[model samples]
Target: MSALQIFVLALVQGITEFLPISSSAHLVLVPVLFGWADQGPLMDVAVHTGTLLAVLVYFRKDTVGLLLAALGSIGIVPARRAVAGSVYGKLFWALVIATLPVVIAGFWLSASGLHAVLRSPQIIAGTSILFGVLLWLADRYGPRVKALDAMALKPALLIGLAQILALIPGTSRAGITMTAGLALGFGRQEAARFSMLLAIPTLIAAGTLAGAEIAASEDTMLWRDALTGAGLSFLAALGAIHGLMRWLSHAGMTPFVLYRIALGLVLIIFFWTGSS
Candidate 1:
C-alpha cells in the first residue's frame, strides 16, 4: 500500500484494536470501503505487535509483581508453592485457562476450509451484529462477579471459548472476550484488563506462527514489504493500546456497542441492496 494508506491503517488499527469496537472489522472495512490496497498480513502483524508492546509497557508493574509473587522470595519460602492467591499466580493460571480454547480453535480455523470462507462480508455483518448485541446484553445483565484475579477457573475458560468466536473475520477477539466477561458480570474495567492480559500469550502465538510462515516463503521482496508494514502496525498499535485502556477504564463500552450496531446495520443494508 501507499505510505498514506499505511499510516491511516496503522492509526485505525492502533485505536480500534484495544477498544471494544471491532478492530478486525475496521481493518477489513477500511480498505474495502475506501478502495485502498490491501494492508496485507505483515502490516496487520505490525499493528497488533505495536498494541502488544503498549499492553506490556502499561502493565509492566503488574507483570513484575506477578512474576515475583509467582517465583516467590529469593531468601524465603518455597517458590513452587508460592501463594496461590497471589496476583501473578492467579493471573498466570487465568491466562492459561483463557488461552486454551482459542489456541486450538484458531489454529483449526486457519488450517480448515473455514479459512477460505473468511473473506465474506455477509458473515462479517452477521457476526458483528450478533456479537455486538451480545455485548450489550452482557453489560446490561451479567453479574457483578469477581475481577479477573478473583474469577473461577471454569468461568475464565468459558470466556475464553467466547473469545474463539473472534476467529471469524469480523467477530473481533477483543470484542467477544470483553462481552464474555461482561456476561459473567465482570465490571467493565476488570473484564477489559483481563481480556488484554489474556491476549498477551494468544496474540504472541498467532504472530509467531504467521511470522514463521512469512519467513519460510520464497519471496524476499514480500518479506521486506511485510516487515515494513508490520513495523508500522506495531508503532500505531502502541498508541491504540494506551488510549483504549485509559478510555475503557473510565467510560465503559456503550459507545463502542453503539458504533458496532451502526456499522453492522450499514453493512447489512449494503449487502441487501446489492441483490436488488
Candidate 2:
C-alpha cells in the first residue's frame, strides 16, 4: 500500500471502529474502493493496534482499577472464581471471559480454513444490512433496561454471547452488543457504555493476535505503514468513541442505523452496477 492508502485506511479504522459502523467492513471496502488493499499482516496489525490503544487510553483508569482489584482477588478460592474477586476485577474478568467466544472462534477459524469469508464482499454486505436492521429495531423497541448498578450476571452473560456475532465482518461490535444489552433491559446509554467497556478486552485480544502476526512479518516498509496507520487510528478512535457516547447518550441509535442502511444500499448498488 502507498502512504496515501495507509493514511486513509488509518482514518477509516479510527472513525469506524468505535461507532456502530463496522470497522472491518470499512477496512475491506475502503481498500477495495481505492484499490489500495494489498494489505499485509502488518497493515492489519496497525489497524488493530491503533484501535486497541484508543481503548486503553480512553479507559486507562478503569483498566488500572481492574488490574488492582484482580491482583488483590487472586487466591485459591472457588467462590471467587465466579467473581473477578471484586467489583472492578469481576467486571474486568467478565469482559475477558466474555471475549473467549470470539477468541476461540477467531483462532479456530484461523486454523480451520474458515478465514476465507473475510474476503467475501457479499457476506459483508448481507451482514451489514441484516445487523443494521436489527440495530434499528433494537433502538426503537428494546426494553430499555436499567443501568450497570442494577445489572445482573445473566444479562451481562447474554450480552456477551450476543457480542459473538461481531466475529462476522459486517456485524459491528458496538451495535450487536448494545442491541443485546438493550434486549436485556439496559437503557440506551447504559447499553452503549457497557458496550464500550466490553471493547477493552476484545481490542486487547485482537491487538495481541494481530500484533503477534505482524511481529513475525518480514516486511519493514509495511511496518512503517502500519505504524503510521496505527497512529492515525489512535487519534481518530478517541474522537469516535467520545462522539458515539455523546450521541447515544442523548440521541439513541438512529444516526448509526441510518448510516448503516445508506452504506449497505450503496454497496449493493455498486455490486449490481459492476455485475451488469
Which candidate wins on lDDT? 2
lDDT of each: 0.74, 0.76
Q: Give the TM-score of candidate 2.
A: 0.88
Tens-digit lDDT track for model 1 on 108-226? 88788686577666777888788888888888787746576677788789988888888786777888888888888788888888888877886676578667878789987667655
Q: What is the total number of backbone clashes in candidate 2? A: 3
The worst-scoring run of ten residues by lDDT in candidate 1 lies at 73-82
Candidate 1 Cα errors over 4 Å, as ranges:
65-85, 213-231
Local error of candidate 2 at residue 125 (angstroms): 1.7
RMSD of each: 3.4, 3.3
**Could you give candidate 2's per-residue lDDT for residues 17-72 as a string of tens digits?**
87888888887787678776457555766776888788778878766666565555
